[model samples]
Structure formats: structure tokens, C-alpha cells
Target chain A: MKGMTIIVKTISSWVKLLIFLFGIYIVLFGHLTPGGGFAGGVIIASSYVLLMLAFGREFVEKNLSLTASSRLDCVGALMFVAIALVGMFYGAASFFWNFIHQQYLADRATEFKLVSAGIIPLCNIAIGLKVGASLFLVIFALSVFCNDFRCKGSARELM
Target chain B: MSDIPLVLPAFVCIPLVAAFLLPILGSFGRKGRVVATALANLAALSLLAMSIASTNQFSVYNVGRWSIPLGINMVLDGFSALFLITVNLVSSAALLFSVRYMEQYTAKPKYLSLFMLMVAGMNGVVLTGDLFNLFVFLEVASIASYALVGFGCDDEQLEASFKYMVLGEVGSMFILLAIGLVYGATGMLNMAYISKAIQNNPTNVVLCFALALFIAGFGLKAALVPFHAWLPDAHSSAPAPISAMLSGILIKVLGVYALVRTIFSIFGISTTVGTLLVVLGVVNMVTGAFLAIGQGDLKRLLAYSSISQVGYIFLGIGLGGALLAAGASPVWASLAILGGLFHLLNHAVSKSLLFLTSGSVEMAAGTRQLDQLGGLAEKLPLTRASCAVASASIVGIPPFGGFWSKLILVIAAIGAGVYWAAALIVAVSVCTLIMYLKVHRYVFLGELSETRQQIKESRGSMAVAMICLACLCVFLGLVFLAPALRAELLEPAAKVLCDGVGYADKIMEFSKDMIVCAD
Candidate 1:
């Protein structure tokens, strides 16, 4: 029974890892596609939420504390603002001023990529971190506060 | 790039960068608070110096030196300069008030940081020459405000903040969708470029859809009658300085500033859009006033009153647009615009003053309930005096800033043959006066409550901030009588709007000149 439980847990964790990776892909490709930082971050958070539901709050908390997540959210938001300010240094009039260096096309005529296209991608990443952390903290806080049960024994066993 | 326009961008950058750093440093306790205060003060001083320097000159900073169509820009026109002054001035005052007032809250550094970020956001929105950048900054300010509103993390605060966040985010989404559509149609995001595109095409259906989206989005931010559900809760829930910031500056910068820029500079006001604004304005004025009268909570009442005051500014601008479109005298149109802009400034001062005073009262008497608190005006003389000035100004009493602005608006409305709008303005002013009177009577004039008899005066910084704003409230009225000052600032800004489609030509000429010089 113990071996069976361990196998199930491992499979679930792998599934969550895949979902998290997919979310990262969404955030990175946000500028090119329909999904952006906000959407991707929420996806990442949802993956964590899925893990927490399957394993338990203790597993998530042990991995990522609510306080730490909130701090990350703040840091992410700050980084986004900082990236916006970089335009001023470059003598680009105001915030979010894009300055593309070069562009290349590959795979298909429709598929094109730029090497240095200002701060859109940076903004996407910053927003991704913010959204992911904020959503994670919000969910984690709600669960921890509302749930009567507390984790016991080893942190891993809490899962 | 050589001239650098250092002061203008610094006004936004300083506070924004400080906001980011404040939380990390705030982990150090008292030292963090001191650092935050000093940084905020420095930013405010920079903004003041920049605002004073840019009074007569209109400057535009081309981001990345990529010219008009290719890069985002920051325009420091007289209108933007005036708002920049208002934002920084009020923020400075609020920060001064918070220096002592925020002591009751545990995380002072974090609070200060968020406050600065909010200021940066408002300043950015006002200065940005790109439509999408405006949206981005609007979100930056708004998200900070949402977090600040729930800073206390109490049940009421959480609920209010959640409601505010949901409504505000929806509004933001609408704005984004509008931007996407505009980009799709015009293939440009810069205001100047978009204006040129609209002038080239002039499609009614697309313009209508865009206008509707703008009205919905900005109206929600402005807390106009139809979209004011979350404001009362959010405003009342926030700490006093933040409450003042939101009611005073945030709505004006994000909502009114954006709306006016889009209509006047981008689309050039049409008859239908003008009429829609007027109708919305009148409805907000009447509804906000009526609702405010029934409120018992001091902050909640101020929140509703903010709605009413915002209505006046909108009505003035809307009337200006209507008259301009109808081929009325340019003088009357300009007068209407001036009134609207001046009222926006006045509201920022008096409403913020009111909120700060309310904070003082809440700090002293430990309650914001009108019925429960009375006659401690003697005990809290500074608070009483400041509240009186703010109340008088907001209610449109003469020799106060609000009165002159309203008078100009009414006279302009009458001149433009919008007699109905003029009448409504007067009616709403009366309603405003009555509500303020109730506030005065319940909170300041009646028999002193024994529970509040020992109420002490608000601390040093709060008192100083309130008094300074009160003084400005009196001094601002003198601007109307001074023709030269009025011509230099208000008239020029109004003319920028009255110029209408001519804006495209001006921008093109300006950019061409810059490019020629660069070459």
C-alpha cells in the first residue's frame, strides 16, 4: 500500500511539473501569442493549487511559504517598474518605449523573432512572476487561514 | 536628449524606484520609515521644481529618440504640468500627514513605498503621450491602490479591496480591449499617430465603439454615477492619506485625464460624444450629491462627494466639447475647459484636505461616525479649521477655489446656450452645500460628545499638512482674478483642446522640426 501511494504521489508531482513548465512557456511567449504574463502566471498558480489539492496544504507550504510568495510578488512588481524606467536611460521618451535591434524569420514566413525588441519580453516575465506569486499567496493564505488541520511529523509527510 | 528633461521624468522615476526599495528596507523598523519619508520628500521637491520651471515652456521627451510614431513620448504641456503640480503637491502633503498618522499601522515602510508607487503611477499617466502606456501606468497606480486599500487586512478592508480590485480590473480590461481595437484599426499606439490615423479615416462606427469603451473604462475609474459601486467601500476602507490620494488624484489622473486626452487630442470631439459626456456628467452630479447627504460615515460621505465633484469637472469639459462642436465662440469653449481643469485642481486640494482632516478626526476621536462625534472642534481646533475650509470650498462658497471654478463653469454653460446644464450645476451646488452643512453640524457644531471631550489635536505633521492645503484653498481662488496667469496656464491648455484636429498638424510639425535638427 505504501509503495502504491508513493508511485501515485510521484506521478501527480510529475503532472504538476509539466503544467508549471507549460505556464512558463505561456509567459515567455505572451508577446507573440494570446497568453501573456497574467494568464501564464495564473496557470502556474493553478498548477500549484492542483498539487496542494492532491497532496495537501502542508506540502505546498513547506515548498513555498505564503510570506515568501508575497515578498516575491512585490519583488516582481518592482522589477517590472524598473524595466519600464530603463527607457528613460536609453533616452526613449517615456516608460515602455520599445527599441528593436534586429528581426529574423525562421520555420515559416509567418514565424518571425527579434533579438532585442525593447522591454516587452522583460515586462512579460516580470508580470509573470508577479501574477504567479500573488495568486500563490492569495490561495495559500486562504487555505491556511480557513483550514482547521495542521501538518504533523516530517514536512514531506505533510504532503 | 542633451537637454535631458531630467526634472520631468524624475518626478515619476524617483517615487517609483523608492516604492520598490521601501519594502525591502522597511524590514529595519524606524530607520526604514525615516528613509521612506526622506525619499518621498525629495521626490516631491523635485516635482515642485520641475513644475515651476516648466510653467511657460512646453516640452516633449521622445523615449529612446525614436521620433513620434516609433517610440513612446512624454509631453509636458501646460495642462500636464498643472496636473503634475497638483499630484505632487497633494502627494507631498499626504506624505507629510502620514509621517505621523501611519504610526498606528505596523508596516510603515511598506505603506510609504506603496504610496510613492501610487504617485509615480498617477504622474506617469498624466505625462505619457502614448495610449497604451497610459493604460499600463493606470494599472500600476490602481493595483498599488488596491493593495493599499486592504493593507489593514481586516474583514471589511479585505472585502472592500476585493470588490475594488474586481471592478477596477474589469475596467482595466475594457481599456485594454479598446487599445487593441484602436491599434488594430489605426496601427499605431502613440496619441499623435492615432489622431492622424483617425483624421485620415473618420469612421463613425469605429469611433463610436472606441468612445463607448473609453467612457465605460474611464467612468469606472472616475467613479461616475453608473460605475461608482466600489468607490465608497474602497475609499472608506483605505488609510487616511491613501483615501485622500484616491479620491483626490488617482481618479482624475487615470480617468478624467485619459478621457479628455483621447476625446480632444485623439478623436477630436464629435457632437454625439459631447452629448454623451454631458448626460453622464449631470447624472453623476445629481446622484452623487443625493447619496452623499444620507451617509453617516465621514469617509464614506466624502467618497460620495468625490463623485459629485468629479461630475462638475466632467460637465464643464463635456459642455466645452458640445459648444465647440456647435461652433460657439472659442472664448466660451475655452472658458468651459478652463473651468473643468481648474475644478479638477480644486477638487484635488479640497477633497484631499477633507480626507486628511477626517483622518485627524478619526485619530483623535477614534470614530468617524457623524452622530457619535460632536463639539470637539474646540479640542481639535486645527482639524476643525481645516475641515471648515475644505467644506466651504467643496460646497462652492465664494472666495474659495471650488466656488470660482463652479461659477466659471456655470457662466460658460450659460454663454454656450446650454442653460439646462447651467441650471443643473447650480442645483447640484446647492445639494452639495446642504450635505456639507450636515457634516459641519453633526461633527463640529453640535454639543460635544463626552466620549470625545478628551480628544487631543492631531500630531505635528498632520496639522502642518492640513493647514498648508487650507492656505492653498484660499490662494487658488485668486488665480481666476489674475488674467495673465489664467491666460498663460488655463487658456493655453484649453486652446490645445479647442485646436481639435489641428493637434495632428502641430505634432507633425514639431516632430519634423526635431528630426531636421537631429539630422
Candidate 2:
């Protein structure tokens, strides 16, 4: 039974990992394509939900904790703010401004690339992380409460 | 299209930074709540100050100093400043109310933080010159509100939150898709630039489709007749202060404001668009008023009334737009827009006061059912007094704010030769009066309920907030009577919309001049 549980958890983790990667792809391509941070973040968080549903609360909690997601959310928000503040330092006057003075970087950015469009791509990435982590925290907290309720119910029955 | 100013960006940033820092001080408990409240209040106060200070000027802040087409910008004309004042003023009052009211919930810090974030999002939506940024901020506010609505975490709260989220998400998606279409067509995200592009190419099928999408999306956000399913449930289920904030300001800031900005500033107010808005407004007025009259729940009734009030605003603005397109005098257009804007401010104060009173009532009596509540005029004198004042204002009693705005709208409609629309306005106002009378009859009049004999007035900050807004509702009519204030604030905003297609030129010229001066 332990081995089977381990296999199931591993499969769930792999599924989550795949979804996370897909979310990353979506975020990175947001400026050039239709999908953006919001879509990507929701997708990533949905993956965690799927994993929790498949492997149970304890299994999911052991693998993915609320603390980590909270930290990620904070960091993501900070990064976005930092990028916005950079506009001030670069004399761009407001947030989310691309400060590149060189024609080469601007011209070379025409091709499908990460550094193109200056701060938009980076902002998108930050938004994705912030959204993903916040969503995960919300879902995980609810699940934790759910587990606690179930545990209390079973213990009451035992008594 | 007036020169985008630096103050506009600060309106969005101050609350955002405050929201970000709120959670960091969470371990200090009461101290955390105090700090968050202070920060939010200070931010709101500063925004109010700046908006007041910049009332006569139109300024634009180019995001990153880039040209209009290349980067995002924040615009602060009279219109934006007026909205900023309304948003900030209500937010400050709401935060004050929450100081004592939120003790019932766990994690007071989180609630304050989310509240500020929601304010930030609404401020951003009002101030942003970029279409995409408006949508983004709209989502930010919507998501925060959804969470706040469910803050209690009860089964009903969660269910309401879920329903709200589903509808809100659909609205956001539609808005995003509209933005995508606009971007694809014009290759520009700035409102002024998009407006210019649309004017240069008025026959784009894609633009028309995008406009349709926007109306639907923003209409849903505003809780117009068809897309109003989530509002009653969500608004009623939220904590009372939140219900007040949502009904009083959220729908206006996110829905009516955005719709007006798009239709007037971006699309230059076509006849078809005007007709569509008028039709939608009429439908919302009748439907919302009728629905409100039927509601037994206090907050639910207020929520439905909000939809009806919003209908009046839309009707005023929409009629103005249609008249303007039909070659009516600019003076009438200004009058209509002024009425709409004035009503927006009046509704924010009065409705928020009403909701806050409801919160006080709920706190004292432990219920919101109208039939179960009675003779509160004696039990909770302060709450009863404020509710009476707010009810008077909303029902368009003389000397109150609502009466003046409704009068202005009716006269403006008649002046513009839309007599039928004026009649609709009057009819709806009558319906509104009847609905509020029902509320008063059931909630505050009649014999005192036996169960609520010991009910006392809500203590501390809630009372202070309600009194402040109620005073505003009573005195707000002076804004129109005073020419300096009206000319300094309302007239400039009205002129911006009246300027119509010239918005793009103004933006480009201002940005270019700034760049040249910098060089």
C-alpha cells in the first residue's frame, strides 16, 4: 500500500510539473500571443488542485506547502513592483516603461524572443507568479480546513 | 485628452503600496490593523487632496515617459479627478468603518489589505489612459472583491463568492477579448491613440464588434438588467461595509466610469452607441427598481437600488452622447454629463451611508431581514437618523444631493429634445422613491420587534463613518449652487467628453511637448 501511494503521489507531482511548465510557456509568450499571466497562473493553480484531488490533502501538503506559495506570491509582487520602479530610475516617468536607448536591442527584439517588448514580458512573468502562488495559497488553505474537518468528524465517530 | 498629469499615477500607486505593506505587519495584531487603516486612510486623503488641488488642470502622466502609442499613461482631467475624489473619499470612510466593524472577522490585517487593493484597482481603472491597464485593474479590483465578499468563509459566503467569481471572470474575459480585438485592429492600447485610429478608420467591423463586447462586459460589471444575477447575491452576502462599498462605488467606478470613458473618450460617442446605452439604461432602470421593490433583504434591496441608480447615470450620459452626436448644443451635453457625474458622486455617498447604516443595524439587531426589523428609530437613534437621511437623499427629497442631480438630468434631457427619456428618468425616480419608502416602512417604522428590544446602536468607528457620509449627502447639493466649484471640477470634465474626437490630438500634443521640453 505504501509503494502504491508513493507511485500515485509521484504521478500527481509529474502532472503538476507538466501544468506548471505549460503555464510558464503561456506567460512567456503572453506579449506575442493570446495567453497571458492571468490564464497561465490559473492553469498552474488548477494543476495543484488536481493533484490535491488525486492524492489527498496530506500528500499534497507534504509536497506543496502554503508557506512556500505565500513566499512566492510576495516575491512575485515585489518583482513586479521593482520592475515598475525601474521606470522611475530610467527617467521613463512611470511604471512598466522599456528603457532601452539602443536600436540594436530594439531591432533584434523583433524576432520571437524573451527580451523583446522591454518590460511587458517581465511584467507578465511577475504577474503570472503572483497570481499562481496566491491562487495556490487560497486553494491549499481551504483544503487544509477541509482535512481538519474530516479528521475531527472521524475522531468524533471513534470516541 | 487633456494633458495627462503626474498626480493621476499617484492615485493608483499610493493604495497599492499600502496594500502591499499591510501583511508585513500582521504579527502585531491590533497595531497591524491600526497601521493598515492609517496608511489606507492617509493614501485616500492624499488622493482627495491631490484631486481637489488638480481640479482646474488636466494632466497626463506617460508611463515611462514614452510616447502615447508606445507606453501606458495615466490621465487626470476633471472627470478623472472627480472620480478620484469620490473613490478616495468613500474608501477612507469605509476603512474607518472597518476599523471597528472588522473585529468580528479573523485576520483583520488581510481584510484591510484586500480592501486597499480593491481601492487601488478601482483608482487605477479610473486613472489609466491605457485600455489594457483599465481591464487589468478591473480584474484586480474584481478578484480582491470576490475574496473580500467571501471573507466570512461560511457556506453562503463561499457560494456567493463562487457565483460572483464565475460572473466576474466571464466579464473580465469578455473585456480582455475586446481589448485584444482593439489592439489587433489599432495596434495601440492607449485610449487616445485608439480613438484616433478608430476616427481615422470609422468603418472597421472589428472595432464595432469590440465595442459590442465592451458594452456587454462593462454592462455586466455595472449589473445592468441582463447581467445582474451575481450582484444581489454577492452584495448581500458581503460584510455590510463591503456591501456598501460594492454597491456605492464599485459598480460605478468599474462599470459606469469605464463605459463612459470608452464610449466618449475612445469612440467619440456615435449615435448607435448612444442608442445602445440609452436602451440599456432604460432597461436597467425599470428592471432594477422593480426588483428592488420586491426584496425583503435590506442589503439586497440596496443592491438592486444600486442597479437602478446606475441606470439613471447611464441614461443621463447616454442621452448626452446621443444628443451630442445629433448636433445638439454643447451646453446641453455638458449639462447632461454634469448631471450624470453629480449623480455618481451623490449615489456613492448616499448608498454607502445606507449600507453603513445597514451594517450598524445588523450589528445591533443581528439580522438584516426587513420584516423582522422595526421601530429602530428609537432603539438606535443615530443609525435611524442616518438611514432616514440617506433614504431621503436617494428618494430625491428636496435639499438633498439626489434631488439636485435628478433635477439636472431631467432638465438636460428636456433641453436636448429627449422628452421621452426625461419622462423615463422621472418615472424611475418615482419608482426609486417608492422602494425606499418600503425600506423605511419595514426597516425603521412600525412597532418595535420584541426580540430587538435590547438592540443598541453600533459602537465606535461605524457611527462616525455613517455620520460623515450622511452629512456629505445632505450638503453635496452646494456643489452645483457654487459656480467656482462646479466650473473648476464638473465643467472641465464635461468639456473633455464634449471635445469628442479631438482627444487624440490633445494627448499627442501634450506628450510631444513634454518630450521636447525635456530635451
Question: What is every candidate's C-alpha DockQ against the true complex, given to 2 decimals?
Answer: 0.23, 0.25
Query: What TM-score would every model get versus the actual structure?
Result: 0.85, 0.86
Alpha carbon lDDT of each predicted model: 0.83, 0.83
Q: Could you tell me which 10 consecutive residues in candidate 2 chain B have the lowest summed lDDT?
A: B1-10
lDDT of 1 by residue, A1-159 (tens): 012266667887889988999999998888787898999999999998877777787777779875567677878888877776766455434444453331222223443353234467778889999999989877776665554236423322212
lDDT of 2 by residue, B319-371 (tens): 88888898878788879988988888899999999999988888888889998
lDDT of 1 by residue, B352-438 (tens): 999999999888888899989888768888898999999999888999998999999989988888898899998998999999888
CAPRI band of model 1? acceptable
CA lDDT of A30 in candidate 1?
Answer: 82
CA-based DockQ, model 1: 0.23
Give model 1's TM-score versus the native structure.
0.85
DockQ of 2: 0.25
Candidate 1 chain A — worst ten consecutive residues by lDDT sum? A99-108
The segments of candidate 1 whose C-alpha lies over 4 angstroms from its true place after superposition are: A1-159, B1-4
